[model samples]
Target: MNEDLTHLTREELIAEVVKLRKGIRAHRDSTMHELCWHHPQLWNLLPEKTIPEIAVPAWPQFIRGCLRYRESLDTQLPDAPRVKKEFNDPDSPSNI
Candidate 1:
């Protein structure tokens, strides 16, 4: 699915840029839960069909990684507004 950029008209190039920007913005705006899910659709933006093998950590390590990610946000966006937890129930499958 390689696109020949050489053949694209000025308008076509602009349209492609706009399309890619929208996709990038959507990924940028994703929340915590969305971040944990696989994003094949985002990968589809490229011209490849191959999927790389993913390595998932064990539960304890995974939770620790999540905690570190939150800690990083504190450092990176210290003054950012906070959102109330949407998945706080301990027994819930979607708890974050």
Candidate 2:
């Protein structure tokens, strides 16, 4: 019987996961780095922290999001007419 897995099935994979998690908990002191990997505080955009340690590029990501939004804009509305509006300035009509 494998000790790591709570259930009896697939013991080897579970052991690997448990080992990895234990290592992270025991030796990793960089929780903020992990958090910042997925969540940018925006304060890190400054000169001291212009680029994050991770390979993610901010501008390219922003552009990709814009492109996706633009593509979704052209999509036809439903019979009830689902209106797409720019919430940034609610008063103005949305192009999408």
Candidate 3:
């Protein structure tokens, strides 16, 4: 992506950045939903205004820090556990 970006003119890069920012903002709701699913309590602590005011600015740095920490650990993290749902039981409405 960086190599591709290098080919873009300054105006094109600015336009791409604007488009990417808008795309990120548009997906914010889904991102928040995923965050709530993983950590409901932490999600609740993040005020609505904090996203635009703080999270956006801090996100890149935070992610970089996380990546550096993960690299330092020198261990592969296990995959997240999956929850199975029984949607087709004999007594379920769909079976009925």
Model 1, 8-66: lDDT tens digits are: 89998898788888888889898755766677777767656778788999999999998
The collision pairs in model 3 are none
Best by lDDT: 1
lDDT tens per residue, model 2, 3-95 = 434544677567666766665554444321232234344333222545556664599897797677545645632332333554456586654
Superposed by TM-score, candidate 3 places the C-alpha of residue 75 at a distance from the truth, in angstroms, of 28
Expressed as tens digits, the lDDT of each residue in 1-96 for candidate 3 is: 257778889998898778766655545544211432333334333224243333432888877976775564455434433334233454534221
Q: With candidate 2 superimposed using the best TM-score fit, by how many Å does residue 3's alpha carbon deviate from the native? A: 16
What is the full ranking by TM-score, best candidate first?
1, 3, 2
Model 1, residue 30: what's the lDDT? 88
Task: List the candidates ranked by lDDT, beginning with the highest.
Answer: 1, 3, 2
Backbone clash pairs in model 2 (N, Cα, C under 3 Å; residues 3+ apart or in different chains), count: 0
